[model samples]
Target: MLPSITPFGGMNLRPRSSGSGGVEEARNALGQRLRELRRRAQLSGKQLAESLSWQPSKVSKIENGKQTPTDDDIEAWTRATDTEHETEALLASLHTLEVQHAEWQRVLKAGMLGHQLELSEQDAKTRLYRSFEPAVVPGLLQTAEFARALFSRAIMVHRVPNDVNDAVAKRMQRQEMLYRTDKAFHFVITEAALRYRLCAVDTMLGQLDRLVSLTSLRNMRLGVIGYETQYVVDPRHGFMIYNSDLVRVETYSAELNLRQSHEIGLYTSTFEKLAAVASYDAAARAVINRAIADLASAQPEDGE
Candidate 1:
């Protein structure tokens, strides 16, 4: 999904905020701590850089949060500042920051096509996919038109490079895994997903038709949580659980790749709770059909 820092004894394990600002803020906090250590040793920036054999700009960048320090960099900084005891804690914060938050601008730097390919690689390694979506269809189940619409919006909103056609093609390519007998897919989506007007009416209709056809697949199980179903747990956000180990959660500005055992367990339990209240097979198709009917009714007749 996406890719934090803390203090010596009081490490800020959680992000300060939900946006990319939180990550940037955490990095700045780390830099401030390192700068404090340097000052406590009575070393000027250039002197510290010289002692560490790093360029003066390197010290400035790290101290300004413009550059993230490597493990070795952290070690050298701690040594030069006579704050070696802080090394372990600093390293822990650095690793946590690297592993937890991945901003969209950086993740999509090469373009959306690259991100799609990376997701494809992830899917290839996963045998059981359990996804819950409260807003839109999961990437694996999205139609080309729907995917195109989504990618176009992302490009505009995130100001990422425009590679919509390539990205859409790659997403369609990823769908080939659906037919693999070795893998199984179980997706639970709220009825709101089907009714969300993210794309044109015709495209939405076609997308719902695709969902209907997919329901009969031997390796795929689709579930629709209708409005009438009472949720056992609050569907706070959408997430995908790959097997039993990892959970991929997407936010407005970043993607969260949660790997902790407790985090995975919580999501797994949440998915089970959502899936239990959902309708499957014919019932799931009925939900899709209803959405299609609603859209069709809204369309003007041939004469008007």
Candidate 2:
């Protein structure tokens, strides 16, 4: 979410979702440390790049937290800076951030079902949960059938173990958190999400109905941004902001846990802007009704 920490080619990097900005802060600190080392060694960026057989800008990017340093890069940097004594301490900090990133492969090493349980645990702890979706229904408001289709798709795409049923069950269990009075939920979705057709017409209609049903809950705020509304901010990827502490964003290849305050605040502002242009209450129901109407029309004629 804070731009990607690494390039797209190889196994990647991630930020912290704990919301204390620990990962981001540490990255910035690492960059500062690297820069201090370079300055202390009286080496220019160009000189270091030439010495390491790397691009000059890479040295600058790593020193500014715009890019993450690989282990090899770290080693090379320390050696170039004549700070070999600091390598262990610096790598220790990097490892702290690495574990928090939760690379998808490592996370799914056990199974997808466990991932759902892990999120369920997070659900139990969150006091205020805000989900902003541009493409699909948020899990907290998904129907059992719709959720099944999603898990099944994940199995096919990610090639994770085929534990769709268990994953579905765990998701439904997480949905129970919505009924808690002490916690509050806010959902902002584009109308396009409802029409994405992730499930059959009937199943999606049921999902839409579920959306309408949840609207009556006092603590839940459901907002649908219809096409009719003018642009607020250019919509980006979907993200879940947990109590102003952390933001979780899923990409095609990985899940990003954004812990930086500025990044979290940016999403909060984006959600509010999207919410401002969204249709709520009765107007929101009308939008849902329209989607349901279209789905019904796509069904076969009754007489046939």
Candidate 3:
């Protein structure tokens, strides 16, 4: 059954302006919804605060969208205001936005290292990492030159960084998680994906060689899905499936975190379909070797 939503004592009821920036816009929107509900119920902020045993300032922050109300708070507010289904759903969306705007730097220093370190750390802890590569090599297996090329593009073309080398080094440092003694590693690749070179032939060759070496480790598993394979789940975009008592699927825009039983079940089902269509063990190694050979053959000899 859908939950109830009520006007929390502190939220404002006005629509947010278009000029609002960053997280403020989200908070303001949530505030406006709560405010409308409270007014409709003929409850003043002070009166509502009295009912909830909350300080007037707490209610004020919630109404102003400066503070996020908890699920319990929302439930209580909704009950107090006598709200129904649609109102509850609209209010629930605010929780998603608030959770998604994670401060990546803070997460990193707190030991997550943003998504990059977090992905590898989870893989190491769980012994499995299911990856779909639509465009480039997964960061965990990237070589220095290939990694540098990718970083150069981001820093120079995208203007996302001031120091290209520093960024590239950070990326390389993140890869160490894959090799940490405590966790096994599993990687799945596609033949077409491996063929699409991201750097010079030498760089691509080194990357492939690294892949070959890494896959040879007893605890490391590599799988290759050929273009000919028929996939039950034809996921065209790249995503990383992190398995560590939870499943996290990362996209370019947002990281989808799944811990709920139903959500985990869904991702597991999709991952199995992808695995079934992939080639593993020696067959996967052959694909990597072939790509490396093809890259070398295409390049001019060093003496020439």
Candidate 4:
């Protein structure tokens, strides 16, 4: 997936599950656990806050899942409530929640190849892939040269260890899933994505051509939203939905994995709205071909 065009925004470290309630449910559960510890210790919220030198509202926020507790906060809370034994378990839960909203640097700690493998594992489990992009081509549909360009930029920007070759190979390997008869893919991209000069003009032209060819796959659906189309919902950022179960949102700093049913439904609806205004089939090809022609025409003549 391509990074969002916007600057890094704060992330919600709340826990999420496969259940209907998703993040809120998991958050509330963690909060409830803390609340139970306090209650068992015979301490009121006000008393606990005062004991820990915290504002009374901090207790409420932590207990209500509005605020995530830091390790120090959890340790202090457990000690104040005479439930120190539960400290480790609570910290474990907190770490689990934190993993769901992983910073890109940490995710790429082992290098880009590791991250690509992680994506491949996720892809292996998904039977239906619905992707929407406003900034660049979706990773699964990206050609090798285009993928290399994107990966190179990511390496330079994030200052991660260089593994472009291995990472690109893994990404290309993942694309093999596209040929599987059991899976289906739906990709919606904006005309602006086609025009973005993220790579050499020649490489982008090849990528656009790749998109044109991908449209003919029996199980794949490609949608292109031209600039002339009026917006229904704001195309905030690109996201991928995997089989109605998971929504992967990439940001400039991190990746958000949303598993809540409601969140998935929201993205699903948004994708449908974007797809509705897209040009598909022959129209989609025409849009892609136009981009190709534009790039070709703009190319400098030999010796110019």
lDDT per model, in order?
A: 0.80, 0.77, 0.61, 0.81
Best model number under TM-score: 4
Q: Between which residue pairs do clashes occur in model 1?
A: 3-100, 3-101, 3-102, 4-97
Question: Sorted on TM-score, highest at the top, how do the candidates line up?
Answer: 4, 1, 2, 3
C-alpha root-mean-square deviation, each candidate: 7.9, 6.3, 12.2, 5.1
List clash counts for every candidate, in order.
Answer: 4, 1, 7, 0
- TM-score, per-candidate, Cα-based: 0.76, 0.74, 0.61, 0.79
Flag the better candidate by lDDT, 1 or 3. Answer: 1
Candidate 2 residue 163 C-alpha distance from true site, Å: 1.4
Q: Residues 120-224, candidate 4, lDDT per residue (tens digit)?
A: 788879999999888788888889998888888777878889998998898899999999999999999999889878789889989999999999999999999
Tens-place lDDT digits, model 2, residues 214-241? 8888889999999788967866657788
Per-residue lDDT value at 55 in model 1? 93
In candidate 1, what are the lDDT values of residues 170-257, reduced to their tens digit?
A: 8898899999999999999889888877779888898899999999999989999999999998666677889887777776656667
* Residues forming the 10-long window of minimal summed lDDT in candidate 2: 3-12
Query: Hey, what RMSD does candidate 2 come out at?
Result: 6.3
**Model 1's lDDT to the true fold?**
0.80
Better of 2 and 4 by TM-score: 4
Off by over 4 Å in 3: 1-98, 101-127, 156-158, 244-246, 301-304
Q: What is the alpha-carbon lDDT of model 4 when measured against the actual structure?
A: 0.81
lDDT comparison, 2 vs 3, better candidate: 2
